[model samples]
Target: MKRLMFYCQHILGIGHLIRSTEIVRGLTNDFQVCFINGGEIVKGFEIPDKIELVNLPAIKTDTEFRELQVPTGFQTIDEVLEYRRDQLLTAFNRIQPDVLMIELFPFGRRRFSAELLPLLDRAKAHGTKIVCSLRDIVVTKQDQVRHEEKVCKLINRYFDLLLIHGDPAFIPLEASFSRTQDLNCNVHYTGYVVQQGVGIREQKIGNGKQAASTHLPTPLILTSVGGGRFGHDLLKCVAEASKVLETKIPHHIQLFTGPFAPDEVFEQLQTIAQHRHNLTVDRYTPNLLAYMQQADLSISMAGYNTTMNVLTTGVRSMLLPFTGNDDQEQTIRSQRLEQLGVVTLIRPSDLHPEAFADRIIECLQTSPTSMQFDLGGVKKTANLIRAIVHKQPVIV
Candidate 1:
C-alpha cells in the first residue's frame, strides 16, 4: 500500500480539521495515512485506527485573527513553532510518503510558512507529489493582489494538484480567487465533501413518509457555535430566544458550546440556561450528526462542515455567519445557500433574543426538504488520487 502524509492547520474553527478527518476516513481503506494536526486537539473527534496521528503543540488564533496563542500550555509561540517545524520536517523525512496532501496552504494558513516552506522543499527534493486541498471560498485579504501573487508563486513552485472540495455550479472557486487564471497546477472539483452519514440519509429520507402528528414528541432543536471561540453572542441570543419560545414551541434545545469556548462564557451560558428546563448546555459531542439527524431545526453558525450537515440531513436551519476580522467567506456561503432555499440567514443586527426567537418561529413553521448537491466528493477524491498515483489521466 502507498503511504499518504496529510497536514492540516486549524486556527479559529474546527471546520478544517473536521472536513479533513472525513476525507482521511474515506482514504484509510486504501492508504497508509500519516495525519499531522497543527492545532488544538478536539477531544471527541474520531479518526480511524489505521491512520497514524501526530498531535503538535496546539496553536490557535482569536476571532479577530490578529493574535495567535498556544492554548495547550505555557510554551512561547517561537518555542512551539520551532518544535512543530522540526517534528513536521522529521515526519516527512521518516514517512517518505508516496503522496503529500496539504489542507489550506497558500490559499490560507499562510501564517505557518516557517515550517511549511521547509517541508515543501524537503518533499520536492524527494519527488513526492504534493496536493493542496481547499474549501470553496477563501477569506479575502485587504491587499488581495499581492496575496494572490504570493499564492500563485507557492502553487507554481510546489504543488501538483489543486483539489477544490466544492462544486463549481454551486459556487465556483474563481468566485473568491479572482487570480485563478495564474496558478500553474492541475485543478479539479470533487464536489462538496459532506459528512458520511448524510450520503446514506438520501435513501432513508426518500422511502420514509413524514409521520402525522396529533401528539408529536417535543421537537428537538440542535444549536452549536462552531469551535466556541467567538460564538458567545450567538449562544447568548439563543438562550434568550429559548425563553421566548418556551410557551409557544415547547421544544428541547441542545446547545453545544464548542470545546474552545472560554470558561467564563461557558459558565455564563450555563447559568442562563438554568432558567429553562427544556435547555441543556455542553462543551462538545462526538456525535453531532446523530443529533442533527434527529433535530427538527438547527441553529448555528455557517461553518462549512456544519452547513453541509444541515444540508445533508435536510434540517431547517438558521445561520449566522462569523464576520470577525472582516471575513466574508461564511457570509457569502450563507447568502448562496439562502438564495438556493437551503437555509435562512440571520443578520448580525438581528441577533438579539427577541429577533432570533422570531426567526426560529419561521424555521419551525417551514417544511423540511433536502436539496441535491454534488455529494460525490469523497468517492471522486479517492478516485482522482488513485489515478494520480498510478499515472492515469483524471477528469473531474
Candidate 2:
C-alpha cells in the first residue's frame, strides 16, 4: 500500500480532529497512513490502532482566536511553533508519503502557514501529490476577496485535488466560497463524511417522538458540547433546564461536556447535577453514537460532527449554532437542516432554563422527518485516492 501522510490541527474545538480522523480511519485499508495531530490530545479520544499517529508539541488558541497558547512546558508560542515545524518536516521526510493530505489549510487555519507553507514546498520538491481535505462550509473573513485570492493561489500551486466532504444538493462549497472557478485543482464532492456504523445499530425507541415514558422506563435526554472550551453556556443551560423539567417530565439527562472543558466548568456542572437526580455529567465519551442511538432527544451545538451524527442516527435534535467571532458555518448548516425538518433551531435567546426546558418538551413531542443524505463519503474518499494513485479517472 502506498503511504499517505495526513495533517490535522484543532485549535479551539475537536470537530475538525474528529472529522479528519473518521476520514483517516476509512483510508487505513487502502493506504499506509501516518497521522500528524498538531493540537493538545484529548484523554479518551481514540486514535486508530492501524495507523502511525505523531503527536507534536501541542498548541491551541482561546475561543476568541486572539492568542496562541502553549502548554505548561513551553515558554511561548514561538517555541512551540518552532518545535512543531521541525517535527512535522521530520515526519514528512521519514514517511516519504506518496500523498500528503491536509485538513482545512487554505480555507481555514491560516495561522499555521508558517509551518504548512514549508511542508507544501517540501512536498512539491519531492513530487508528492498534495490534497486538501475540506469541510462543507468555510469561515468567512473580513477581506473576502483577498482571502479567496490567497486560497486560490495556494491551492492551485500545491494541491492536486480538493475533496469536499459534503453533498452539493444540500449545500455546495460555492455557498460560502465564490472562488471555485478560480481554483485550478481538481475539486470533487465526496458527500458528507459521517462516523462509521451510523445506522447499523438497533434503534431502541422512535426518533424523538414519544414523550416521557409512562411505562416502567424513563426517557433519555443527551447533550454534548464539542471540545467543551466554548460551549459552557449551552451545557450550563441544559443542566439548569433539567432542574426545571424534573417535576414536569420523567427523564434522565446525560451531559458530555467534551474533553477540553475547563476544570471549573466541569466541577460546576457536577455540583449542579449533584442535587438533581435526573441529571448526570461526564467529561468525554468515545461512543457518542451509542448515546445518540438511545437518546429520545439530542441537544447540542450544530457542529459538523455532531450534526452528522444526529442526522445518521435519525434522532430528534435541537441545534444551537456557535455564533462567536461572527462564525456562520454552523448557523448556515443548522438553518438548512432545520428547513429540512430534521432538527429544531435553538436561538441565543432560548438559553434560559425555563425557555430551554419548554423547547425540549416541544422537541420531544415531535418526530424529525426522515430524510436521505449522502453518507458515503468514507468509501468515496478512499476510492478517489486510489484512483488518483493509479492514474485513473473517477466520475466526481
Candidate 3:
C-alpha cells in the first residue's frame, strides 16, 4: 500500500480538520495514512483508529490574527519556525510517505513557508508525488492572484498536481486565477467532498433532542454562526428576530453559538433566550449536520464548510455572511449557490429580525428543491491520490 501524509491547519473553526478527516477516511482503507496537524484542536476530531495523528507544537491565532503566546520563553518568529521545522523534519523522517497531500499554503501560510519549502524540496528529491488541495473559492482578488503565481512557480518546480474540491461548471479556475492556462496541465476538479457515512444517517438523542422532547413548538428552526469570531451581529439579529416573531410565529428556535464565542457574549445570549420558551441556545455541537438534517428551516452564516454542509444535508437555509474582514469568500460562494436555487442569501446590513423571521416562515412553508448534484467524488479524490502515488493517469 502507498503511504500518504495529509497536512492541514485549523485556526478559526474545525472546517479544515473536518474536510481533511473526510479525505483521510476515504483514503485510509487503501493507503497507509498519517495526519500532521499543527494545533491541539485535532484531538476533537473523530478519526479512525487506523490513521496516525501527529500534533505539532503550533500556536493558535485569535480573531485579530495575533498568535497566542506559547509557554516557551522564546518569542521571535525564528524560534517558532525552528521548533516547527524540527517537528516537521522528525515526522517526515519517521513516516517516509510516498505522497504528501498539503491542504492550503501552496500560495499562503507564509509563516510556515520557511519549513514547508525545505520539506517540499526534500519530498521532490525523494520523488514523492506532491498534491496541493484547495477549497472551491479563494478569499480576495489580490491574495488569489499572489496565490496563483506562487502555485504556478512552486508547482512547476516541485508540486505534482492541483486538486480542487469543486465542480468547474459552478466555479471555473480562470475566474479566480488569471494564469489558469499555464497550470491547466496539472489541474483537476474533483468535485465537492462532503462529510458522509453512518454518523450522518443516525440522529443521537443528545441534549438537543432531549430539550426538544420536553417543550415542543411548531416548525423547528436551527441557526448557526460558525466560529463566533464575527458572529456578534448574527446573534443580535437572531435575538431581534425571535422577539419580533414571538407572538407572530408559533415555532421554537435553536441557536448554536460556536465554540469560539466569548463567555460574556454567550451569557448575553442566554439572557436574551431566557424568557422565551421557544428559543434555545446551544454551544459547540460536534454533529451540526445532524441538526441541519432535521431542521424545518435553518439560519446560518455562509462559511465554506457550513455552506457545503447545508448543501449536502439539503437544508432550506437563509445565509447571513460575515463582513468587515478579508473573509468575503463565503458571501461570494453563497451568492453563487443562491443563483443555483440551493439556498437564500441575506446580507448582514439588510438583516432585520422581523423580516428574517418572515423569510424563515416562508421557507418553512415551501418545499425544498431536490439536490441533484452527485457528491461521490469525495471518494474519487482518494482514488486520484492513489493513482498519483502509483504513477497511473487519473481518469478525470
Query: Best lDDT goes to which candidate?
Result: 2
The reply for model 3, stretches above 4 Å from the true place, is: 40-44, 64-74, 141-147, 197-218
Clashing pairs in 1: none
lDDT of each: 0.84, 0.88, 0.73
Clashing pairs in 2: none
RMSD of candidate 2 to the true fold?
Answer: 4.2
lDDT of 1 at 62: 76
Output the worst ten-in-a-row residue range by lDDT, candidate 1. Answer: 199-208
Relative to the unseen true structure, what is the C-alpha lDDT of residue 301 in candidate 3, on a scale of 0 to 100? Answer: 82
Which predicted model would earn the best TM-score? 2
Position 369, candidate 3: lDDT: 61
lDDT of 3 by residue, 1-396 (tens): 879898886666666777788888889878899998875463234777889988777555666555654525567767876787788778888889898888876644666787788888878888888888878776554466667777778767877888878777777655556676776436778888887633333221322345324223447688888766667777778877887777887777888788777888888888888766678786666667767766778888887678777878787888887654466567777788788778888876657777777877788777666656646557778778877877787764
TM-score of each predicted structure versus truth: 0.92, 0.94, 0.89
Model 1, range 322-346, lDDT digits (tens) per residue?
Answer: 8999999899998998988888888
lDDT-superior candidate, 1 or 3: 1
* Clash counts for all predictions: 0, 0, 0
